[model samples]
Target: MKALIISDSHGWTHELKTIIDRHRNQVDVIFHCGDSELSENDEALKGVNVVRGNCDFGDDFPEELIESVGGVTFFVAHGHHYNVKMTYVPLSYRAEEHQANVTCFGHSHVATAFMENEVLYINPGSIRLPRQHPQGTYCICEYDEKEISVTFFNTHGENIPELTVAFKRK
Candidate 1:
């Protein structure tokens, strides 16, 4: 299965829609890591799994989400509550508790992906305001029985070659 992960849009609905439209048919699922700043009933989030961020004021948004797709369990969060900018310990512990194969979050607006303790952790970065990277980015993950491949893309749908990574499932 393939999943498209994005975060920290911070209210640029048009960009979000463009990204979603660009990959809607190609990916099996779409995840918005938070700070969307859009209302819960907004069309931009119609079919995406989303969470609440520190900047989000919507009462309808959840703080975290657990989703199962193609035999893989995913732990989703905005990461502020776990203090992800300082450390991953809290988030990692939460993932372990959920028995998640992958953990998706956004907070620092840094694009990064890695595997630790058999769990894949990914932060798609901020499409509206990037920090560590030159371009605003998001991530696409393709997974199967043997391995998982993650590719980062710019807001314009261009791939960030150097950021692409693959890992063998444990």
Candidate 2:
């Protein structure tokens, strides 16, 4: 299965559309990790599984979403409630509670991916305002019964090799 994971667009509607468009034919699932600052019904958000971010106001969105797509269990969130800017400890527990194997989130605006406690945690970073990297970033993952591989890309659609990671599914 292939999934496009993005976060922290923070109001750059066109960029979001472009990114989705660029990978439209390549992914089976699309997850937006919030901070879009757009309404839940916005055209750009259509067909996307999104969670509420700190910047997203009102009760327009849920605090989190847990879904199974293409046989993969995903726990999606914006990470403020769990203090993602500090650590993934709290978020990990929540994912564990849901028995999720993949956890996707955004809040720290830093792109990272890792395997811990037999679960994969991914932060696609901020596609608008990024830190720790020169350009804003996002990620795509290819997975199956054996392994999961994630590759980060810049706004222009070029892959950031240094951020790409793959893990043997246990």
Candidate 3:
């Protein structure tokens, strides 16, 4: 299955819509890692699985989500609740509790994807307010029996090959 993972849009509904539209037919699921600043009922968020960030003021969005898809279990959160700014150890513990094979989060605005302790952790970065990279970014993940591949893309849908990574599935 293919999944589109984005985070820290902050408030750019148009950008999120454009990104989603670009991959709407290619992905099986879409996740927003929070700080969208959009109402839960907003049309842009219609089919997007989203979590609340420290900046979200509504109660509609959850703190995290646990979903099983294409044989991989995913734990998606905004990361603030798990102290992602400091370390992934806390998030790792939470993923373990949920028995997640993958963890997706945002807060650091640093895009990265890697596997550790049998769990894949992904940070799609901030699409609107990027920090580490010169351009805002997001991630797309493709999962199959042999391996899972992740690729980061800029806000304009340009692929960032330097950040692409793949891992063999166990």
Best by lDDT: 1
Q: Cα lDDT for residue 159, model 1?
A: 92
Give the lDDT ranking, best first: 1, 2, 3
Using TM-score as the measure, the top candidate is 1
Superposition error at 166 for model 3 (Å): 0.7
What does candidate 2's lDDT look like per residue over 1-170, in tens digits? 99999999999989999999899788999999989999987888878888999999989888999989888899999999999988899999999999998999999999999999988999999999999999999999888998999999999999999999999876
Taking every candidate in turn, the Cα RMSD to the unseen true structure, in Å, is: 0.7, 0.8, 0.8
| TM agreement with the true structure for every prediction | 0.98, 0.97, 0.97
lDDT against the true structure, per candidate, is 0.94, 0.93, 0.92
Task: Give the TM-score (vs. native) of candidate 1.
Answer: 0.98
True lDDT of residue 93, candidate 1: 99
Between candidates 1 and 2, which one is better according to TM-score?
1
Q: Model 3, range 1-170, lDDT digits (tens) per residue? A: 88999999988888889998898888988999999999988877888999999988869899999988877789999999888999999999999999998899998989999999988899999999898789999999998888889999998899999989999987
Candidate 2 stretches greater than 4 Å from native: none
Q: Poorest 10 consecutive residues of model 3 by lDDT?
A: 39-48
Q: What local lDDT score does residue 88 receive in model 2, on the 0 to 100 scale? A: 90
